[model samples]
Target: MGAQVFRAFRNFNLENRAEREISKMKPSPAPRHPSTHSLLGEQLRHHPEIKGEIASKNDKLLALLKDVYVDSKDPVTPVQVKDAETRQEPKEFRLPVGHHFDMMDIKNIPKGKISIVEALTLLNNHKLYPETWTAKKIAQEYHLELNDVNSLLKYFVTFEVKIFPPEDKKAIQSK
Candidate 1:
């Protein structure tokens, strides 16, 4: 198309030949491509299954690459497939919240010196379920001195249980 004609087609005036050509063009029929308005307008048809074929080929290629990487894993880390399920942001669910443990184990402490697991549970419960695990309450329930309860709190920190009180957590978050 001539530059001036192209520019005129892009303009508002209907006096030009370009305008007449646009007016003469027939209205679009039902789209065979995207199904206009779920079966409405004129659409240039293209095979959509071609996209599925392309995706299958890409998956096959990725599998081949993963196999090669696995064959060389002696010197390389294994590749991980990540998706919304696999790569979720890690969440910390303070003590009373973790899903895996048995509450029965915590409640039924064996009849001896409190085991390390019991100690950990005792300390965790103190922070997690405060009404039931208050300093005086835990000491009274476990028949131990308040000093022993304090010692257990210090002891678990060595095993990576960083107990930040809610106030401390809030302060850290604000900073």
Candidate 2:
């Protein structure tokens, strides 16, 4: 009878240990996402569709902002603002504007594999205009980020869409 009780007690201890081990193996719940008022959302790699939608929305917002804040064509330069006393006002400021690039003014690139930015520069240098060539088209063909494409386009316009880039005056030149 004593042996039987000892066996039963041993069984009970083993069952309790198994339960404890199972509890330990269970995973903890993921942390809850914080509200926008608390902090910006963390960037995640999953959900490609959602990311694409967000990127497109950002592009539209950027385009709208550019339209409202900047004019590429025929920008107005700021001159000295005269007060009633014929004194210049400190309020005089020029709006930052990019030069308008004529698409056709850009050169055509030869059929070859090259980085999109390099291809653009080459086309600008040769002044070979293609019927459907554009930064967006090039970006799509190369599977590149739209933001990168737009930035290069902005730089192209800033350089007056010329074949030669503006010399970097700040770079150290070896005498």
Best by TM-score: 1
Clashing pairs in 1: none
Estimate, for each residue in 1-175, the C-alpha lDDT of model 1 and write its tens digit. 6998988767756568577797796988765655454433222135566556656657687888888843343443345433434666654332322324464444344222455555667777866787877777766666567787767665654335565668645545544
Model 1 ranges with Cα > 4 A deviation: 1-112, 158-175
Per-residue alpha-carbon lDDT of candidate 2 for residues 5-72, written as tens digits (9 for 90 to 100):
99898888797899889878668797666675244333444445766676665767788888785547
TM-scores of the candidates in the order shown: 0.25, 0.20
Predicted structure with the largest lDDT when compared to the true one: 1
For all candidates in order, the CA lDDT equals 0.58, 0.53
